[model samples]
Target: MHHLGVSLIVFACVFCSAVLGMYLHGRLPDHHLNDESMGVVKLTIGLIATLAALVLGLLISSAKSSFDTVNGEVTRDAANVILLDRILAQYGPQTDDLRVLLKQSVARGVQIISSNDRAQIASLHTLDAYKRGETFQRKLQELTPQNDMQRRLQARAAEMADEIFALRELGLLQATGTTPIPLLVTLVLWLCIIFCAFGLFTFPNATVTIALFLGALSTSIAIYMILEMNTPLDGLVRVSLGPMREALTVLGQ
Candidate 1:
């Protein structure tokens, strides 16, 4: 499901659970509403609440860390690309075609990343890009270096190309969703139980309902943010494309 849809479902489950608890409050036997029963309920809910909060904190931290790592990798890859192009340029006019191919590859990558379409982003990880990269590598290896300087430049360019390819694969793997669905479901379930406990202990009124509504909405938004951060390539909280785009502009110049 889309992040927003998942969030909405969370909100509905939480708020409705609270509403259901309120209904049960009025219908339950008088003994069930005793002080001892209420105390036990609070204690159980407290434990669940603590667990939920811890899980949420861990998820947010993990998502943010993943997002930052990918962003840094992309920036580093862009710099490497520019460096490789310069090396090829220094190798002489014989590398002109190689330089053009390098630019095209970068341009294609920039276009795919900028689109923010999941399908297009997935395409980047597919065999098509891999084949193109292999072809580039094969051509680079076929170059006949006439002197020591040209030979060294060719070797450096090949190394940089391999590094770029590895980084690309790493980024694509990171772009895939990292959050476990079952974990999220369990968290939402805990939240719903907590909210229901809140309603069970309090009388339903406009003020209580509004408070529950806001709480549910806030929780949903938090989940949404976590999901967005996990998908840094195709969502609102995406990694910046400025580095790669700038590199594309510098290519073939």
Candidate 2:
């Protein structure tokens, strides 16, 4: 299921469980609602709550790390695009057509990545971008430079093209993958259990109901944030396009 949907379900389940607990508290035997029973329930709840908190923290950290890594790759790729274009420019007028194609490829890349659609993300895995890089390499290869300097520039440009292609491949791999769904499910289950325990122990009062609601809401928001960070491209938080936009400007010059 989508992260947003899962988050909502979690919130609803916890909220409903709290409400049900309040209703049940009125009918339960006095002994079951006694201090001793409540104490034991609280103890169990504490342990479960601690575990849930740790897991959630780890998930946030992991998602943040993944987001940063992918964002860095994208920035590096854009920088490489500009660097390769500059190299071709230095290679003399023979590469003018090749430079234009490289710029077009960069534009294509920007368009493809700007969209958050699943199909657009899937397209990243194909050779559409790589084909353009390959064309640049082929044209560079055909050039017969008159001097050592020009020959070296051609080699460097070729190497840059290869690097750009490799980076794109890595970016695609990272962008398409996500945090494990089963792990998230387990976390949500733990949260449900913890909230259920909370309901069992607490008296059904206004303050308790409000507290329980707030806790569930907060937990749901945290999960949503983690999911957003993991997806990066299509969420409340997204990877910035500053680097790509800058590259586009440089290409225009």
Candidate 3:
């Protein structure tokens, strides 16, 4: 499901739980809601709340860390692309065709990564990109050098190309959503229970209803942000493509 859809569902579940609690409040006997019972309920809910807070904190940290890791990988890959191009340039005019090919490859990569279509962004056509990288490696290997200097440059260029390919593969692997579904489900369940507790003790009124609504909405938004960050390439939150775009501009020069 889309992240927003999931978040909306979470909101509904949480808010409905509160509404259900209010309904029960009227039906329950007075003794059931007396100070002694209320005290126990508060203590139990407090423990649940603490556990929920810890889990939420962990999820946020993990999602943010994953986002940063992917961003760094992209920046590193862009730098490597530019460095590879410069190495080819230094190898002399014979590498002109190779340099042009590198630019085209980088452009293709940028197009694939920055595509607005979720289907395209999710798939990334990694196989095709890998094939192109292999072809480049073959052509790089075919280069004939006239002196030790040229030979060393050729070897270094090959190594850099390998590193670029490795980085791309690593980035692709990391791009897949790693958030555990069960953990998310458990967190939402905890939120519903907490909100239900909120409604149980309070008298219903416009002000209280508004407060409940805002609380549920805010909780859903937090989950939405976490999900969005988990899939950095295809959501409101995305790794910046500036570095790759800049590398594309420098590729043929």
C-alpha lDDT values of all predictions: 0.91, 0.82, 0.90
Q: Estimate each model's TM-score.
A: 0.96, 0.92, 0.96
Judging by TM-score, tell me the better candidate of 2 and 3.
Answer: 3
Clashes of 2: 0
Candidate 3 lDDT at 52 equals 94
RMSD of each: 1.3, 1.9, 1.3
RMSD of 2: 1.9
The per-residue C-alpha lDDT of model 3 at residue 10 equals: 95
- Cα lDDT for residue 238, model 2? 80
Better of 2 and 3 by lDDT: 3
61: Cα error in model 3, Å: 0.6
Runs of candidate 2 with Cα error greater than 4 angstroms are none
What would the per-residue lDDT of candidate 3 be over residues 9-72, giving only the tens digit for each residue? Answer: 9999999999988888888899999999999999999999999999999999999998999999
Per-residue CA lDDT of model 2 for 131-203, tens digit only, reads 6566777877898898999999989988898898888787777765577888888888888778777776667
Which residue pairs collide, candidate 2? none
Candidate 1 overall lDDT versus native: 0.91
lDDT score of residue 36 within candidate 1:
95
